[model samples]
Target: MNTVVSYIKEWQQALQSEIQFLKKFGSNKFLVSNGRLLSTDGSYSYYFETTTSLRIPVGSSVRLEWGSMSQQGRVLSSEGKGVILALEQSFGDLISEATLFHDPWELLDHLIERLDEIKKDKQKRLRVKKLMDPSMPANHPLEKIKSNVHELVLRSKYNPVTFVWGPPGTGKTYTLARTAANKYFQEKRVLILSHSNQAVDVLLGELTDFIQKKDRFREGDVLRYGFGTGERTDNRQAITTTELLQNQDPSLAEEKEKLLEDRKLVKQDIARSFSKRDTNQLLELETKIARVLEKIRQKEIEFVKDAYIVGVTLAKAASDPAIYEKTFDVVIIDEASMAYVPQAAFAAALGKRVIICGDFKQLPPIAASRDSLVTKWLREDIFHRAGVVDWVNDGRLHPHLFLLEEQRRMHPDISAFTNQYIYHSLVGDHESVRKSRNKIVESAPFPNRASILVDTSFTGAYCLTERTSQSRINIWQVLLSFHLIHESYLSGLRSIGYVTPYRAQAQLMELILEDLYQEQRLNADIIAATVHRFQGSERDVMIFDTVEGAPQSRAGMLLTGKDSERLINVAITRTKGKFIHVSNQAFIRRHVFQGKTLRQLVEHQVKQLQTVETKDIGKWIKHQHLKLQWMHARKLENVFQDIETARASIVISLPAHTRLSPEWLEKLNNREKIVKLTVISESEWMELRPDHRVAEGLSFPFIIVDQQFLWLGLPLEGTKEIQPPFVAARLDSEKVSEYLLSQFITRE
Candidate 1:
C-alpha cells in the first residue's frame, strides 16, 4: 500500500476508535426535569434520570444536550433515581458552549512534534519562489493585497506559514478569493479552510463569482465540500468534488446512474415489501442501498482528491480522513485569527504552503479562560502570534507577512482615530474614503464634525439598568439612537446600525426599534447587534451605544480592559459615512479612560459641541432676514408666537381643516397690510392623512422657519395628538430644505 493511503487508513481507524469511545463513555443520556428551589438555601436543583444504571461521581464535569442546545454543569449529587446538576452559568452560556467539543490535545501535540521534525529537516526546507504572473497589474480594489499574497505564496515555498494582516474593511475576503483563483488558473491544487462555515461559504461564493466572470473556470474546476447542495442554488453551475470526479469518467457516471436507478427500484420494492409486511425483502433492499451508498462515498473521495480547488470548514477537514490522503499546494485560511491554533495547524499540515488572512485586532478566539496555560499554548492562533512578533525590524515582512494598510470602510475622521490609536499609524487612508468623508460632510447636519459624542451627563440621560450578570442596558442611549436614526434617514442614509457591547442592551434596543418600526416611527431595516455579532460588517451610519454609565465604578469596570478596547475599536470602524458615540460624559472621565482612541474621540466631540452655540427655532428666525412658513392646525399658536418675535418675513400655509373664524381672517387680512404676513390656505394639506406617512412614523406637519432650520415631527398617522418628540436640526443647505418643502406640496 502507498504511504499516504496507509497513513489515511490509520487516521480513519483512530477517528473511528475515538467515535466509539465517545459513544460508549463520553455521551450520557438523561431524562431532565426542573427541580424545586429551596427558599432558605437559595439553591435550585434540577433532576436527571439516567437511561442506564450508572455512577456519576460528585463534582464531575458534564454537558446536558437537548434540542440543538447544550449546557455545561457539574454533578452535585447522584443516586439510583438520577443525578442533580448545578449549571455553570446562564442558559444562553449553555447554548453557546454546545459547539464546544473535547479538545484534541494528544493529536495537537503529535502534530506539533511533526511540525518540529519538518522544520529541523534541511532537505524538507522551503525554497522561496516569485509569482508566476508578476506582470499582472493591480487593478482590482484588493489587488495590492492580492499582489502581496502572490509574494506570500512565493515565500511559502521557503516558509511553512505566511500571514496577511487585514484590518477592518480592508478587503481580506476579496484578496483571498483573487489569490485562490490565480493559483487555481495555474493548475495548482488549493484547499481553503476557515473556522466558521459562514466564512468558508463567503470565500466560496466570491470564488464562484470570480470563476463565472472569467473564461478560465470550467464546470469541474472548483468543488465545494461540507456545504449543502441546496445552499448553492444561486450558483448551480458549481458542483461538488464527487460529482466533478464522477463526470470526468463516463464509465463511472454511467455506473453511478445505474446504481442510482437500481437503488430507486430497490426502494420501491422495499415499499411494496413494507405494505405486504414482508420483513425479509425489506431488510435485503436496505442492505443493498447501504452498499450502494458506500460505493458512492468511495467515488466521491476519489474525485475530491483530484479537484483543483476544494473548500471546507476547519472542523470538517480535521475530522474527514479522506482530506488527509492528498497533499495540497496551497492552504488558505480565512478569519484565521478566530481559529484555534490546533485547528489551523491541522489544516496547514495538509498543504505545503499556508496563507492566513485575518484581523487580530478585532476579536480573538473564544476560550473558557485566556489565562489558562494550556489554552495559551494550544488555542492561541498562529496568525495572532505572528502579528505580535516584530518582523518589520528585520525587514522579513515582505516574505512572510503582509500588513494591508489602506482602509476603505471608514470616513477619514473615523479611520484616523483607529489608524492613530489602535494601529499605531500603520493604516493609510484610501482616496475613496476621502471622497466619502467629503460627501457625508456636504450632507451632514453638522458637516464639519464627522464624529459626534452625545453627552448624557444629565440626571436622567445617563441611567443604566443591570439586566444580567454580564450585561447592562442603557435607556438613554436607546432613546438617543432613535433620534440619530431619524436624522440619519432624513440625511438620505438608508443603511444604519446600532451597536452595543452588552447582549442585553442589544436585545433591549432591538425591542425598542421593533416597536418604533411597527409604529412606523423608524425604519425596520435598521439593525441592532452586539459588537461581536456586528464584526466583518459595515454600515453608512453607525450609532454605538456604550451601555456603561454610573455608578462610576461599574462603568469603569466595563471599559477598563483590553477586551473593551477591542470592542470600542470595532464599533468605531464600522461606519463608512457617519459615527456617533452615545455615552455619559461622567463615565468617560472616570480613570482617564485606558484606551487613548476612545478618549481622543470623546474629547474631540465635546470640544466641537461646545464651540457650536445652541439656538432654538425662535432664536434662529430672529437672526435671519428670510421668509418663514408656518403649517399645520394645532401648532399655529406656537408658530404665531415665534413669528411675532421674528424679524423675518413670514408666509403661513394653514391646513384646510383649520376653521379660522371670519373675524380672525378679517383681522389677519387687515394686519397683512402692515405685517409681511401672507396667509395661504393649503387645501391639499387636508387630503394628506396618516395613511401618507413616509419611512418611519414621520409625517408632513413640519415647521420650516426659512432655510436655516427644519423642525420635523414624528406623529403616528390618524392620531389626533401630535407628540413633542421631534427632531430639530440646522438646515445648512437649501437643497435639503427644498426636499422637505416638496413633501408638503400638492399636485397641480
Candidate 2:
C-alpha cells in the first residue's frame, strides 16, 4: 500500500509541474523526459546512446514509440530547450483519486443517523389515530396508500426544500402527482414543473386524471388540468404532449427532403464508379458521398417552441410577483440538475416552499465556465458552504436525500449495465429485492432482452452539415426515444412531471416534436417534455443521450451536458422497465472531460503506481503547499480519469505543445502563406536569405529576413511608413541552432 501511495504522490508532483508549465507557456513548446537529461536551456550535442534518451525537438522529430511501459522512452528536448510539458503526466494525479471510490459505506452510515432524526421530528408533529372504516375509512382513501408521498411533501413544506431521488420504474411521477394533489386538496396551491416537456406532460396528465377521474370533477370546468393541455383561464396553455407536436414549422420537412435527395446523388456517383470497374474512384466516391449524406441528414432538428417561450411568457404571465408568490403554496421542481440558475431563481420567486428532485450521478448542466454555478460550487467551494458541508458530513440535509438501496426499472441485464456504466451505489440484484417483484425486468435476460441501444454516432459535421439550429443534437431525442421504448415495454401508464432548475431543454424538445409530427404523422404516443421537464415525476421507461454531437458524422460530435442529464432523469423516471442511450462517443468524451483528459491520465498513473517501490513514498506523496496536498491532487486526477475511461475511444486529448517556425507562426497569425515585408534602411532591413549554421545537433532550415517583415519589430506612422529594426534580428540564436541542427540530423 505504501508503495502504491508513494507512486501516486510522485505522479501528483509531476502533474503539478506540468500544469504550471502550461499556464506559463500557454501554447509554447516544452521539453519532456522519462529517463533522460540534456544541457540546461542550451544546445546539447551529446545525444543519448539509446532511443529513450534521444534529444529530439519538442514538436519536431519526436517520433511516438508505442510499446510496453518499460520499453518506452520519454522525450529529452523540445525546440532546443530541455522542457516538453508532459500533459499525460499532469493527468496522472487525477487517477489516484478515482481508485478511492470503491466504498461509500461511511456515507450511508451518516445518512441513516439523520434519517432517524427526521422521522422523530415527523412523529412529534403528527397526532396518531386509528382508523376504523369497512366501506370508508375515517381518513381519506388517498391517505391510506403510501405515507412516503405525504412525508416527502411535509418535508418540503416545513424545510422549503426536499430531494426526491427517483430511480427508474419506481412510479416517481405518479407518487409526485398524488403528493401534489394532497397538498392542493389541503388548500395548498401547488405548481408542478420539469426540465423536459415530456416529463411535464406526464405529470400534467396524471394530476389532471387524478382530479377528473378519482376526485369526481364535473365537465366544462378548469378543476382538472395539467400545465399545457385541454383548457385553462389562467392565461396558461397546458401544452399536451400532442398539442406540442403541432407548433413546429414545416421548413424542417423540406430540409430533410433535400438532404435525402443529395444522399441519393452521392450513392449514384459511387455506383457509377464501381460500374466502370474503377476501384480507386469507387472508394473515393464512396468516402465523398458518405461525407455529403452526413451533411444532409443533420438538417432535421427543430426548436421546442413552447418550452422556450414559457420562461419569457412566465415573466409576462404574472406581471405582479404576488400572483406566483402567494398563489402557490408548494412548488415542485423536477430534473433540478438540468435547470439553469436563472430558471431556478424564477421558480424560487413563485413560493417559499419548493421541492426539488434529481440525481447528481447522471448528467450535469451544460454551462459556460462563468455561468456554471452548480458545478463551480460543487467542485471548488461546496465544503465552505454550511449547507453543503452539512449534507456531505451528516449525509442528511433538507435539500437532498439518498434513495438508499432501491431500483425498480430496467431488466436485470440492462440495469446491471447502467449501474456499471452510469449510476452507482443504488439499484441491482441486492439481497433486499431478490424475492420481491421489483426485479429489473419480469422475464428479459441480459443477452436476449429488447436492448436500450446506446448509439454513439454524430449526425452532423462542421464542414458539410446544415440544419435548423435548434434541432442539431437536441437533448429531446433521448426523451422521445424513452417514450417510444418505455410505452412499448412498460405499462400503458404515463407519468407526471414537475419543473425544476429551468425549462430550457424542454423548450428545445418541443420543436423536435413538432417536426416529428410534420414528417412522420405519428402522434399517438402519450409523452411530454417541458421546462424543468419532470420533477416529482416518474414513469415506466427512460432513455438518455448524454453525449451531444452534430446531426451527422460530417458536422462532428460533442457531449450533451445539462440537457442530457435532465432528459435522462425524465426518460428513466417515465418508464418502469427500460432505459436507453443514443449517444455520440466523441461528444460525451469531449464534454465530460472538458479540456482535461481525466481517464487516460488516471490509468497511466495507476499503471505507474503498480510498479513503484514501497520506500519512495516521500517523493510522490509529500507536498509543501496546502493547495497541492496529496488528497486534492488525487481526487481531481481520479475524476478526470473516471470520465476519460468511461468514454475513451471516441475522444482524444491533444499534446500540450505544438512546434512552429517563426515564419510559420507569422503565417498562422496572419492567416496567410506569404510573408509581407516593407524595407527602408540597409542596416535595419535585410533581404530574405538562407542562414546556414553547421553546428552539430543544432542545425535546421532558416530564412533570414529584415525587421520590417516581423509584426513585433516596430510601429509604423503615416509619414514614416516604418521604423528601425532594433526589435528583429535576421538570424537569432534559436534560428542559428535550428539551421545547424538540420545539417547534422535527418530532415524527416
Candidate 3:
C-alpha cells in the first residue's frame, strides 16, 4: 500500500474484479439507450422517454448525450419508461435523434489515474493514513451536548479524520450542511461530498438556503460544482461550474471564446476541404475541433477551484479536474455508508481534515462484485474498512467513531426494534418521534400500528413463487406492493416509496404500478425503487418488498452479508410514519440461514404484529395480503390430492425435468368426471399427457387445481432442474394469475 503502483494495482483490481465474475450482488449498474424528448418545464427541467424501461434508479446522476452534445441531470423521478430529469442546462436544440444515457461511474477512471499524484503530497498522505487508521479516542454523545463537537471536528487540526454514524432521519444532512455553512462563514474552505447527485443537491439545498438567508451571497461563492440543476434551492446566483466560468471569470470566458473560434475555423476548413474534394483532411480537422472542445472544457472547469463551499457527488469531485488543483480545509463526505471506499479515500486524501458521515448499518455500495479485493476495499463503505462497524457489531465501541443515537424520523414503535437489534441499545428516539402528531397509526395507511409485516406464509403460500432468475419477482409481493400503494393513495398519502432488493423486481413492480395508475387505482407519484436507491429520501408511507421464497437452496445474495443488514436498516428507517414489509416468513427462516436481518425482523416483529393470515383470500386481498387457492404441496401425492378435487380443469406447469409417477397421472386421468388437464411442460411431459400442450420454457413448475390462476412451485431444495419432493407454496388470487400463467405457458 506504500507504493503508488501497489495501491493502484489493488484499486484497479477492486474496480475491475466484477468484470470476470457473475454479478450476484450490489446495485444494478444503470445503462439505457435511445431517449427522446418528452416534456419540458419551459425553463430548466426536461423529461425524456427511453424506448425501453431500464431499472434506472431514480435520483441517479446521469448523462444524456446526443451525437456530441450532452448534459448532466439528476433523475427527479421516472414517468413510466421515461425519466424526469432536472438538467444542469436546457437543451432547447435537442432533436428527435437518439440520445444515450450513462452513469457517473463512466468518468471515474480519470480520477483513479490522478490519485497517485494526489498522494504525492506529504501532508495529505499523512492525513489519509490518519483517516485509515486514526488513534483519536471517541468522545461521548454527551460531550457533543456539552461542547460544540460538530464544529470542533470540522475545525480539528490534530484529528484529521472523524466518523459520524448518522442513522436514518437523524439530521445528518442538516448537521453537515450547517457545519459546512459555519466553515464557509468562518472563511475556511469546505467541500461537501455525497455518493449521489441527489444527495449533493439535498445537502446543498439546505446549506445554500441557510447561508443565503444568513448573508445572501454577500461575501463568498457557495457553489454547486458538478450539477446544473438545484430545483429546491435558488440556483440563479450560485450557478454550476460551467455557468460560473461562462459568465463570471473573464479569463476562462475569453479562453472559451478563442476555443469556439478555433472550432468554427476547423469546421470551416472541413467545409472548404469537402468543396475542394480533400477527403483525407476531414479526419485531421475533426480531431483539431475535438482538441479545441477539450481545451474549452478544461477552461470551463477552472471555476471549480474558486468556490468557497462546493457540494458535489464524490464521483464528480474525484473526476473533476479543477478539484485536483485545490485543497479544502475540510471535506465532509455524507452518506459514507453507501459510498465506495475509494470515494471516501478521495475525500480523506484531499482535505486536511475530514468528516465521514454515514450509518455503516445501512447499505453499502451496490456492487455486483463479490471479490475479496473489491469487497474489502473498493466496494465496502469507509465505515467497514475503518473496522469501526465491526467493533459496534461485536458490542464494542470504536474510539474515533461518533454514533448518532437520537432519531427524529420514525415513530417510537418503529424505531424501538431497530434500537434494540441494529443499534444494540446505543440509539434512542428523539422527542419528536413520540409526538402525538406523528402518530401514523392514527392515520389511514396503517390504522393499527406504525409498522407491520405481512407474513405471506399464513396467507396460503404459493407452490411456485413469483420469482425469476435473480429472485426478481414474487408476484404476490409485487401485487401486495401494488395493493398497499393503492390503499395508501386512497387514504390520501402522496409521498409513498416502495423498496425492493432486486432492480428487475423494482422495474416489474413499476410496470404493475403503471397499470394501477392507468386504472386510477393509484397515484402517479408512487415510486418503486431498489433498496439502494430509497436511501436519503423520506416517505409518508413505505413498503419494503423482500422478494420471497428464493427458488434455490440458498436465499439469494440480497438476503446475505452486512450489506443486507444495511439494506434492511435503510428501508426501515426511511419511513416517517407507516411501514410494512410484505415478507415470506417461511423463506427467511429456512433459506436466509446465513443472514440474521430478515430472520430477526420476523422473529421480533411478528411477536408484536397482528398476524394477518391467508385462511381466506378475499379478506387478505382486501388488505393486500393474498393467497388461499394455491396450497403448499411437497410430495407429488399432495399435488395429486389437490388435482383429484379439480372438477372443472387442471392446468399443470411443472418443471420440464420432473419425473412424475405414472400411477399419479393414471389416477388423475381416471377421475369420476373427465376434466380437461393441460400439461404445460417440456415436449417430453406433453408426450405422457397428450391432453395438454407444451410449456416451452417453464423453469419452476406448479399446478392450479380447479383454478384458472397459476400456482408456482419451488422444491425444498431447489435446483436449476428441480427433482421430485421439492417444497412449493400456493397463491389463490385470480388477480394477476393470468399474468403469471402467461410467463409459464405459450398459448396455442
Candidate 4:
C-alpha cells in the first residue's frame, strides 16, 4: 500500500484516477463506488485525490445502514465504524461562497490535465488503474443483500430489470433511491417515477432532503445535474405542473382521438343492447353500461395526463433532435404495479437505463388495462422485442434489478397480520420479522367504547331519517364531539376515513361529516362516503355508526361479497390506533346473525379425567387452551407453558389447598343472597324503590330519545323495596313529572 503520489498542483490532477476509471470502465465503476456509500443507514462522504493528484468528489452514506465498516484505506474513509457523507449545497449558493469550486467545466479541465501526468508513469498508471477498477469485493462496502443485487445489475448491463416486492414499512422507497443515487454518481442521468401523486410527493420530498444536504450537490448543481424540476412557485414545481396540463402535441392529440373513438364505440354497443332488451333486461344493461363507460373515460383521462406530462417535460429539457440520445443514464419508477405497459414504454423510450419499483402484492393497475403491466412491459418490450435479451440475461438494464428482501417500516405483529391476510406468500427466514414478542402489547385496547340502545320491538325505521327529531339529536351529539376532539390533520397527517354498508347509510355518513364541519370547527382534510370510496386508502382514525332502518328479514343483511369485505377491511384498518364502531348494542344483538360470531365457532372440548391420568388431561387442556379464540387466553397459556417447561428441571413442593365451609354457604344463602317472593296488591305493585327515579314505562323494549334527551341516570320503577340500576325514560320536560309519577304511582 506504498505510493509515490505526484502533486501536479491542479484540480484535474486531483481527480485523475476517477476520470481514468470512468473512461476505461464506463459508468459502472462510479456506480460501484457510490452504491456502497448509499447502503449505509447514516450519511457519510469523502473528497478524494487520485494517484495523479486529481481531485474527485466521493461521498459515503452512513445514515442508511445500521452499523459501520472497518478501516480498509483512505479510498473509502470511515468515522470510527460509521460511513462518511458529503453534505449537499446548492450550486448558486455554493458558487456565491467559493467561485472556483462551483464550476464543473473548470474542474473537468484541471482533472484532464492531471491525467496527463499519470499517462507519463507506466507503473504508477497501472497501479492506479487497478485500484480504480471496482471489480474487487473490498472496493464496495454495501450491505451483503444490496451488494449482491448491485452485482447482478452490473452483470446484466445490456438489459437489466429487477422487481422488489414487499409489504408496507419495508423501505421499498429507500432501496429505489439508493440504486438511483449509485447510478447517478457514475455520471449517468437517472429518472425517478411514481404512479401515485402522494407517492410522487413523498419521494420528491425525500430527494429534496438529500439534495439539500451540505455535502451533497447544491440545489443549483442538482438542477444542472438534471435532478431539479423546472421551477418552483407557491411551493410547487411551476414549470412541470403547467406543462403537464397543456401538452397539445400531435402525439398527445392522437392518443386522445383514440380514446374518444373507443368511448363512442362502447356507447354505440350499449345503445344497441338497450334497444334489443326487454324492460328488465334494459334496466340491468343500463346500470352495467353506465359503470363501464364511466370507468373507461376516467382511465383515458388519467392516461392522457400521465403520459403527456412526463414526456413533454423531458422533451422540453432535451431540446436536442437525437431520438436515441442518452438523456438519462438511469431511471427509477415507484408504484410500478399501477403503471401500464404503455406508460412504462413511454418512460423507457426516453431514458438510457430504467428501473421500475413497486410491490405487486399491494395493488396492481385497476385501470382498463388487460395485463400485468410491469411484467409484460419489462420482459416483452425491453428484453425480447428490443433484442436486449443478452443484457437482461446478464443482469443489465437491457435486463433490470429486482429486490426480494425487505428492511424496516412495520412492527412484527402488524407485518405478520398483513402477510397472513393480504400477501399471497409467507414471509420466511427473516428472524426479525415475527409476531410481537413484547410483554406489553397494547396500552389502550379499548380507547373508545360505544353502546347502542334500541327500542323493545326494534321497529323504529325512523331512527336514521333526517326528518325525525331523534336523527337531529344523534347528529348533534356527534357534531359536538367532533368539535371537542382534537382529531385529524389537513396534510402530513394519517388519513381519516368513514365507512357504511348501505347507500343511504353512506350518504348519511357524508352528510354527518359535512354538517358537523359546517356547524363546528373541524380541521379535517379528506372524507369518504363509503368503504368503496376509501378502498386502498388508509386513515389515522375512523368512525363507523351503523344505521338501523331495515325490518327483520333475510334482505336486512345488506353486507355481502366485496361490500362486506370492503366494510370490514375499511373499519379495521382505518385507524392505526383505536377504531370506533358506534351503533346500538341492542341492534347488534338483534341484527347481527348469531352463527357468524367468531367466538361461537370454538367448540367446548369434553375430555375425561381420572386418577393417575393427570398428565394426559393436562396435555389435552394445553392444546385446547391454544385453540381458544381470545388472544389474552392464548398469551396466558403460552406463558404458563414456558414456566412449566423451565420448572421441569427441578423438583417443587406441593401445598394443601383449602375448601369452602358449610357454615359460610349457610350464611350466604340465608342473609347475603336471600330472595323474597312477595305478591303485592295489583295497584300497590307499582310502588318500589322510593328513592329511585321513574319513566312512563313505554311498551318499547328500550327507551328511545334523540340529542335533546338528557337523563341524570337510571330511575326506579316503583316507590318501595330494593332499587334497580336503570329505568327507561323519554326526556321531555313538559311531561317529566307525569311520566315519573305514572310509573311509580298507579293511576286511580
- Which candidate tops TM-score? 3
Model 2 per-residue lDDT at 626: 19
TM-score, every prediction? 0.58, 0.35, 0.70, 0.37
What TM-score does candidate 4 reach? Answer: 0.37
lDDT of 3 at 646: 71
Q: Please state the error at residue 33 of candidate 1 in Å.
A: 12
Model 4 poorest ten-residue lDDT run: 601-610
Q: Against the correct fold, how does model 2 do in TM-score?
A: 0.35
Candidate 3 lDDT over residue span 416-535, tens digit each: 878887888888888867674354556655565678777666332332433455345666567656767767766666778899887877876776655436545333457889887787
Candidate topping lDDT: 3
Stronger candidate by lDDT (2 vs 4): 2
Over the stretch 1-748, how does candidate 2's per-residue lDDT look in tens digits?
2332332233233333333443333222222223221122232211212222223322222222223221112332221221222222222211111100011122222222322332343221121000000111122233433566766765555554455665555556777777776675565556666545455656655665776556543222212112243343353333332232223324444454455455445434433432333323423443454454344333211112112111112221222222332335566666655553333334443545656555554445442223233334322211122133245345453233524235654445334544533444345544433344244333321212323444323322211111223333232233323333333333332332212122333333343344332333242343445423343344433444332344333322222333443344344444444343344444444434533222222222233332122122233222222111112211223322322233111111111122333543233233212333221221221222212212221111112222111111111111111112111111112222232223233354
The parts of candidate 1 lying over 4 Å away from their true place are 1-150, 228-236, 239-303, 384-388, 391-399, 436-449, 459-469, 518-525, 556-558, 592-597, 604-748
The 10-residue segment of model 1 with minimum total lDDT is 127-136
Q: Which of candidates 1 and 2 is the stronger one according to lDDT?
A: 1
lDDT of 4 at 681: 22
Model 4 C-alpha lDDT per residue in residues 341-447, reported as the tens digit of each score? 33344344445445555544333333221223323332122223233334434544321324444533233433333344433233422455233212112221222
609: Cα error in model 2, Å: 30
Q: In order, what is each prediction's RMSD in angstroms?
A: 17.0, 28.5, 10.3, 29.3
